[model samples]
Target: MLRIKRLDIFIVKSFLLLFIGTFFICLFIFMMQFLWRYVDELVGKGLEMSVMAQFFFYSALTLVPVSLPLAVLLASLITFGNFGERYELLAMKAAGISLLKIMRPLIILVCFICVVSFYFQNVIGPIAQGKLGTLLISMKQKSPELDIPEGVFYSEIPDYNLKVGKKDRKTGMLYDVLIYNFKDGAENAHIIYADSGKMEMTADKQHLYLHLYSGELFENLKSQNVKSQNVPYRRESFREKHTIIEFDSDFNMADASIMSNQATTKSMGTLKASIDSMTHYGDSIGRQYFKEAMGGAYSQPSGLSKNDTLRIAEANIASYNVDSLFEAATLMQKQKIISSAVSRTGSLQGDYSFKTYTLETNDYQIRRHRIEWHKKITISLSCLLFFFIGAPLGGIIRKGGLGMPVIVSVLVFIIYYVIDNSGYKMARDGKWIIWMGVWLSSSILAPLGFFLTYKSNNDSVVLNADAYISWFKRIVGIRSVRHLARKEVIIHDPDYSRISDELNALTARCRAYVNTHPLRKIPNYFKLWMSVGEDNEMKAINEQLESLVEEMSNSKSVTMLTALNNYPIIAVTAHVRPFHIYWLNLLAGVIVPVGLFFYFRIWAFRIRLSKDMERIIKNNAEIQDIIKTNNNL
Candidate 1:
């Protein structure tokens, strides 16, 4: 017990060291990826160092749960792998400590980590996500510094475009400036041309003011009364002009409260509350839509019957025949009736379209919130799941360090990431159910984790290289002859010539039977497949030959032994009988195409069986001749 305690301590200590290092390393990698994504928005904006520090802090916090699973995966893999590689695991197992017992301590640690991850996701994650979102918005709103280039029109300013031909930067002078203004409206556009201009932002950094040495202002008035292509316009010439453009160039942080309404920025409790509220709202709207669709009530005219329904009431339709109604009414009356009916249908269609869109939008929002709610738990639970996967996988592979472990870990994480991300997007887009999409990765990997753990505990060589190589060989048409060990038996004085004669007669009979009784009729195959039957005569002959060969192997005759080697072993592998696997028949019957496939497949097998019988006859004839030659001597 003392030794086991020491070993447990050593394992935990080793795992902790690897876990800490792997955590930060994985965190750094994720952080670098995050940086790459937002570097464009973050770089060269003159952001304060403190703000950048805060951004990095929140970003790291957000990535903790993200990196936790992979870190635990890598760390667990390394820990167990190092143990296995150094034969420490073998020693522990040999000393009566099972793999599960060895895993007990680390499993507890991982469970604790899972709880902490859940807490982080529910508490810290939302806050960091909220803050990060707010900061990013603030950054996006922060205008680029007041540096306008020459030649191209710079329109970063609100509703205005400006161009400068040249600038004397040393003296802060400009030449040949053109400006376009559409602040009021695009149709009421205003253009300004100047020989020289200078632009500067206000001291408050809220606006840009342009001063021109010589400029002309032109404006167009939009009017519907003007029939000509050319509308009325105004022009003014000035030796010097000034224009002011609204531009907020300061970095003002947005209110975090502004982002509090988003699902990503909400805690699990908040998300649940919102989901319930929205669900109730959606249900109410759906009920209302159904009520409206069923035409619960309508303000019909006083003369209309109460029995009249929404979609062509019996009395109303019966009273209307196009030819008779047209004959009864004047042309003007008919036109009026048709127009009223068309207008009414058009109104109802527009109303239904609006209601449908409203319901769809509400349902989509509900799905997104529910998706996020499930994501909170699933992502947290993934830490434990990945531990199960990585730990057993490492024990199975029995490799350590940065070589195979890295590749396997990365590939597994990539598959998990792809599944999780795809599920998230699909759920958010309403393509999949909330729970299904949110739990997709966990659901997929949980069984895999169990399977690997089982294999590891059972000491199964699931990743054996030789097994895969054998399968590969079979795929490419390479077949090996089955070899059997020779049984030690006391040779008996037997009639070798009689044995050979019997073998030759059996082979000729089997060959003749196979050729004549080959499955020539399609109905026979169907009957055999349906009844799960085989040719009993051939089966009896095969059994007789096997027994005869067994008896003759004890003969003190070399020719007999050589002949036995040529004869093939046989079993009833012909048809899947009715009393066989219920599910197989059910599947084959349910999927008719596959059943037909098997039908033809069995037909082809019968042909191959006939050929096998022929080969047996030829080999038996050779054996008979060999024994006969020995007898003649």
Candidate 2:
């Protein structure tokens, strides 16, 4: 049995509070996005409140899998950020608790969340998606509420266009209405002009009732005698007329079975069954097509085997010339033969085209089912991957609240979204393998999570801007001038004799190294990269130079300290090779572009090194001269 620690409880409670809040916030955001995509279908359908409630509820359920990973990322980031900002993490570490130890409870929590995500994706998500899809189709099929504006034609009614010149708002009456009816075809249209009319829906809301006070109606009549020159029609005037138009305003839910075959409406088990069935179906169709191609047009003639046909063709090979035979034939016979060949070719082409289309459709469905099957597992794993990344990153940055965490989370999530979406499209289009495309985002982010966790656990300065800046400076050979100020209080005075001897030895070493190495000449390319060793002579010279500067700094003289500041800070191993490992150096050398870049970079460093050595020699001579002058005084 495992005992629960107070520390674990505290960590878990803090994470849960934040997780609940972030989860809902993320859910609402995704739901709003879903609503925006189908807003047009829902806007004018006049759906009931209960229907809308179901719409959003089902939408939330369908969006849960997408929202969970982002929620985990943000919550973990804020939780760890708060810990680091308040120095709570520092205290825990001081008390001998490791970062990984403190994160143990949350890791377990995230794993549970992953399990829940998978369950929702495989079980709950499909049902909700089916319901949502059915609801959307019903909404789109439902007629818009009847509202005819003044001076505009309303075409919302089927087969009719009505324009109202004016209306009475209180009485719900129309004035100067013009209506066109094309129910009997446009050629036999009916045109009506009504002085006043009122429109209302029937009790069942399945038909529209139109009552006109005074109107003139013109109806076109189709002529029975085709040869007659005169067209016939009818005109009638009515003081009161009632017309019924077929308009169904009542909301009727569509058949949910219509969406049952959709890939989004299937669970993992169903998806596997569907994929197997479709694959078998596709394979059978492929084999049928192959058999037809082999036997239909390309087969030997009736009662003749392939070998018999080949033997007969070989015997007649020299006796028949198709071009000469065509020239010997009558023109009409040649035309008949050409027409027959063209007809046969067209029939065969159409048949094969139909078969190809059928196979492609079946194969596409199989890919969809396979893609959905892999999606259930990949999306769940992303939740765990995101937590490791967020927790360590938050600890490294040491920021809390919404400001920094929100920005970082958004950027990271955007990267994940882009990679995941691109891979999804690629896989769906069959441009990439199903597993590789679906797993692309997880593969890319797994290493990042590991790297951040390792860096944060070791308390490394991975996120420090100064560290990167220093590295960039070193890479570009940008050296800094040393600054040494005179001390007002000194514990020990410098011995001019000892400093003088050291400076002479350092200057002699620098001159000898610079002279022998010939830094201005180009180095051997192979030796520069493949050979790996530090320049011990330059290393010893730099050490001695620094020591001499330290001893001379205690002098009371201001000029002596000023001369000490001019000594250049030498990069010990820069001029030798790009990396310490021989393989890495060889890799850089093998790739021409990369090798060329490093080669020129090393050459520039060599030039800088030569200048640095000259400066060291000059600074040494100046200090030695100052020491001699002081000794005489």
Candidate 3:
């Protein structure tokens, strides 16, 4: 049996606290984004508070799966980041605990979250989506609240346009009102001008009642007896006129069944079933279309047997050229034949176009169902993937609080969102396979998560700038020169006689090596790669050079110390083969491009080696001269 330690408990508690807080933050952000997309539909409609609350509730449920992965990423980052910032992670590691052990508990929690994410995506998500869709459709159909502003024609009403020059807000009365009623038709519209009016909705909220005082009405008359050029109209003046306009302000919830067939409103099982049914349906439609085309468009004509039609078609093709026949025909006959062929071609085209549209619609539905099925699994897996990435990254970065972690988390989430959305569109439009598109983001990020985990566990300086800079410099053959400062305290003075003898030996060795190697010429390709041993002679020379410099650093003479610093730090084996293994070198040489790269690299190193040998010989001579001068003093 495994026991839970205090360390695990502490980590679990810390992650949970952050997870809960960050979950709400992420959900709110996603909800706001979702709401913004449909703001036009929801705004200006006189929806009740309870209806709005239901809309929000269903929207939140639908967005839970998307929000969970981001929450996991952010929470893991902050938890591990705090542990690293407080040096708690270091302390645990120092106490003989591995990074994996510290993370085991949170890993379990994240796994549980992943399962919950799947449940929400597969079960609760579809139902909420259906309800939300229904609500949005209902909201879109509902009429806007009645508010007629001054100096603008209000056409929100069904068949009327009313303009008010001014209005009394307290008394709810309009002034200088002009109304155009197009109930019958635009040509026979009734125009009314009122000096003052009061508008109110009926108790049923189904009609608007407009009462105008001192108004004149002009009504166009349409009569069968009247001539078209001389139309009659009716004009009436009244002290007060009341007109009833039809307008429904009441909100009616749409039927949930309207959105029941949508792909997003289906569970995983339903999606699979729907996909199977749609596939069969699409296949049947395609076969039917092919059969129809064969029978109708390319079939034998009426009263003609198959053999007879085939013989006739063959004879026509062999005996006559259609262009020559057309040229021989009369002009009217040619025109008639052309018109008949064009009509037949248009009919076939239209028939096939309709068939193609039907098949495409079925295929589109099948793709959507397939995409949704893969999405349920991909989003759940993303929760786990994100935690692995965030936990390892936080430990690597070693920064806590909202600032750095938030920025990193947002940047990472943006990349995931972009890739995921692009893949979704491609898959939705049948440009990519559904599984590949839905899982694109996860596949791309999985290796990154694994790499970060490996680096964090091994305590690698993966984020260190200086390490990358040094590697880059080495790759580009940019050498670094030594800068040695003179030491204030010397325990022992240098022996000029002993140093003089060593310097002469070193100078002779450098001269002999440079002459034997012939650094100015290119090395033998086969021997350079197929040979495996390092440049042991150069290695020994470098070692001996460093030893001499160490002993000479205690010299009292400034010129002697300066000469010691001038000896270059050589890359001992770089001028030889690329690697120590013969097989790797063989592989590199067998591949022409890689061989050429390493060949040029070796040549460059050879040139640098020649320069280094020259510097060493000169420095040795300077030191020898300095020692003689000190001896003379």
Question: How much lDDT does each candidate structure score?
Answer: 0.80, 0.90, 0.90
> How many backbone clashes can be found in candidate 1?
1
Q: Candidate 2: lDDT over CA atoms?
A: 0.90
Listed in order, each prediction's TM-score against the native is: 0.67, 0.81, 0.80
Judged by TM-score relative to the true structure, which candidate is superior, 1 or 3?
3
Judged by TM-score relative to the true structure, which candidate is superior, 1 or 2? 2
Residue pair clashes in candidate 3: none
Question: Over the stretch 240-289, how does candidate 3's per-residue lDDT look in tens digits?
Answer: 99989999999998998999889999999999899999888888888888
Clashing residue pairs, backbone N/CA/C < 3 A, model 2:
none
Model 2, span 122-201: residue lDDT tens: 99999999999999899889999888889999999999999999999999999999999999989899999999999999
In model 2, the Cα lDDT at residue 143 comes to: 93
Candidate 2 RMSD computed on C-alpha atoms after optimal superposition onto the true structure:
5.0
lDDT of 1 by residue, 1-633 (tens): 888788889878988899999999999999999989998987756787888898899999989998999999999888888888888888888888888888888898999999988888889999999999999888877777666688989877778888988989998888888888988788888999999988888999888888887789999977668677778899999998876778888789998898877887788889989989988988998888887766633545456566653334445655668688578998899899899989988988889899889888887877877887887899889999998998888887878887788888999999999999999998888888778888999999999999988888887789767778877653332444434334577666556767767886797688678667745445353454446445677777888777777776665666567667767655345433333765676567557787776666566555655666777788777867776787797
